[model samples]
Target: MPFYLEIIISVSLLTGGVFLLVGSYGLVRLPDIYMRLHSPTKASTLGITGVLIASMFFQSHLKGFLSIQELLITLFLFITAPVAANMIAKTALHHSNKPAEKTQNQALMDTIRDRESPPSNSIK
Candidate 1:
């Protein structure tokens, strides 16, 4: 392998390792459900992406043809991370004790319910 390519791969691996470490730390240390989402969803994403890029580069250099397994896996990870995160967040939201009233989303439902119901205080 060329010296420059080795350097690039080394840097990529180093950066990816750092990102993975940070992401794991954040997972352990971050507060709250939403805040914790930032760590795994964002850092892990970039970290794993770097690893995938590194793998692809290293594989291609060694094999003389593009190796797409890592690329496809990376694509799948990118596409699925958000969904998995969303599911997690949704589950947390569903189970959490956080006040539903604070969201103001209930206001929309309130209005809809009022529209559908006969007003009790409408000065009948």
Candidate 2:
């Protein structure tokens, strides 16, 4: 309703749109799976968070009360995005039948191998 609130919502929506676009572009243009994972996980999370914030602002301004659903969704997205990305990356590494040039990190390789193999010692 007010000029400043309208400006805030507009800016937030625009920023979210821009971040989402960048993430989409990265998914298409990046060379490898590992590189591609960074885009959607990081940028998209920020983008969604921004959009959700804008929604909360707009709704509160309209209804004269703060909305909780948008806050919850934003919180869920922030918590889950990185975890989902990690799982996808791990799955990719596991199923990569061919040696990928991009997967050169020795620590990651070691961690995946460790996860695959059974523990040597049993907890009696």
Candidate 3:
């Protein structure tokens, strides 16, 4: 309602919008599925968080209570975003069947796999 508060809300929304735009660009411009996730996971999260935090400021003064809806949404966003991204990547990996670039130590993996393999249960 106040002039200064209005300015603050406007600026906050602007910043959040900028972040959302950047994230959308990253989603479109990124080369690979893994890289594409940076757009929504990092950039969009910041954008939404910014907007929610700004909304809290705007609502608190009039309502006399800090609303938890925005806070809960932010929390859910943080929790779900990464899991969703991971599911996407994992599904891609499963469907593609092409091996990832073996940049890591193959020897290490071999050793670990040998250690972790289940013992042959049926002694045929």
Candidate 4:
């Protein structure tokens, strides 16, 4: 392996590790469900993406050909993480879980309520 490739892999791994640590810390230390949900969904997605990129590069270097599995996993993770997070957040809202005291965003609250409530016009 060349020195540059090693450096790239090391940097990617280190960045991923750092983001994962931040996400885990946020999950443990954040005050409420909404705040806690952000770390794992956003930070961990980036973290996993970095690790996956490193894996892809490492595998390609070893095999002398590009690897598809890691790419697919990365794509899947990117697509699913946000959706899963949204669903979890909606579930929490449906159960009446409030955000932390310092968080006050009425527009977002109104949007969620609008989505949950029935349409104003209904056929009799």
Candidate 5:
């Protein structure tokens, strides 16, 4: 492998590692489920994306062709992370999960939950 390729891979891996570490730390240190969800869904998504990009680069360099597997993994990650986060947020709202004292827009969550719930008359 060329020196430039090595440097690229190293930088990508380091960036991924940093994001992963930040996500992990945030998950552990954040006060509530809503805030904690933000960390892994966003930061860890980017972190894994970075690692996948590095893998794609390395594999392409070695085999002289792009790696479809890495592309698929990245695509799925992009698709699923936010969807999963949204689902989790909805679940929390369904359970009336409380946000931390400092969390903003507390009423917005209640509004959303109300909007998503069918009217009582509809149940008849």
Candidate 6:
């Protein structure tokens, strides 16, 4: 209920809101799925983290105890967002999703996609 606490909460909420907006904008404006994946995974992760941190602070200040649930959620989100992004990217690659014309490292992508098959004699 203190003035300083309100300022802290407001600042955190603003930061989170800004990051979330940026991430959403990036998702809509990016040219390709691979590029789009970076926004929600990275920017939105930080965005939600900021909001959760604000929640933790406000809850702790109000209740005189830290809320473990928000902490756990934050931890879980941090762990899973990148992993989910990785899986989605791999799926996109498996489906042969093409990058934008101006995308860099075209040869690297092709090389990864066209790597030589392992020998038939190799372990199954």
Candidate 6 Cα outliers beyond 4 Å, as residue runs: 116-124
Candidate 1 on 1-124: residue-level lDDT in tens? 9999999999999998899999999988865665678788889998998898999999999999989999899999889999999887667665643423334354454344345545789857
lDDT tens digits, residues 18-97, model 2? 99999999989887787888899988888988899899999998789998889999889888888999898788778763
**Can you write out model 3's per-residue Cα lDDT over 1-124, one digit (the tens) per residue?**
7898888888989999999999999999876665777799999999998899789878886798877888899999999999999887667654553333643343553444345445688546
Report every candidate's CA lDDT. 0.80, 0.84, 0.79, 0.88, 0.91, 0.90
Runs off by more than 4 Å, candidate 2: 97-111, 114-124
Each candidate's TM vs. the true structure?
0.76, 0.84, 0.73, 0.86, 0.88, 0.89
Among these predicted structures, which one has the highest lDDT? 5
Minimum summed lDDT over a 10-residue window in model 1 is located at: 97-106
Residue 62 of candidate 4: its Cα lDDT? 95
Q: Which ten residues in a row have the lowest lDDT in candidate 4?
A: 115-124
lDDT of 6 by residue, 1-124 (tens): 9999899999999999999999999999999999999999989988998899899889999899877778899899989999999999878876889999888887787777778888998957
Off by over 4 Å in 5: 116-124
Models, CA RMSD each: 8.1, 2.7, 5.6, 3.2, 3.2, 2.4
- Put the candidates in TM-score order, highest first: 6, 5, 4, 2, 1, 3
Would you give me the overall lDDT of model 3? 0.79
The CA root-mean-square deviation of candidate 3, after full C-alpha superposition on the true structure, stands at 5.6
Error of 3 at 28 (Å): 1.0
What is the TM-score (0 to 1) of candidate 3? 0.73
Backbone clashes in model 5, listed as residue pairs: none
- The best-first sequence of candidates by lDDT reads 5, 6, 4, 2, 1, 3
Q: If candidate 2 were superposed on the true structure by all CA atoms, what would the RMSD be?
A: 2.7
lDDT per residue as tens, model 4, 1-124: 9999999999999999999999999999999988898998989888998899999999999999999899899899989998999999888877878778877794587577657455668635
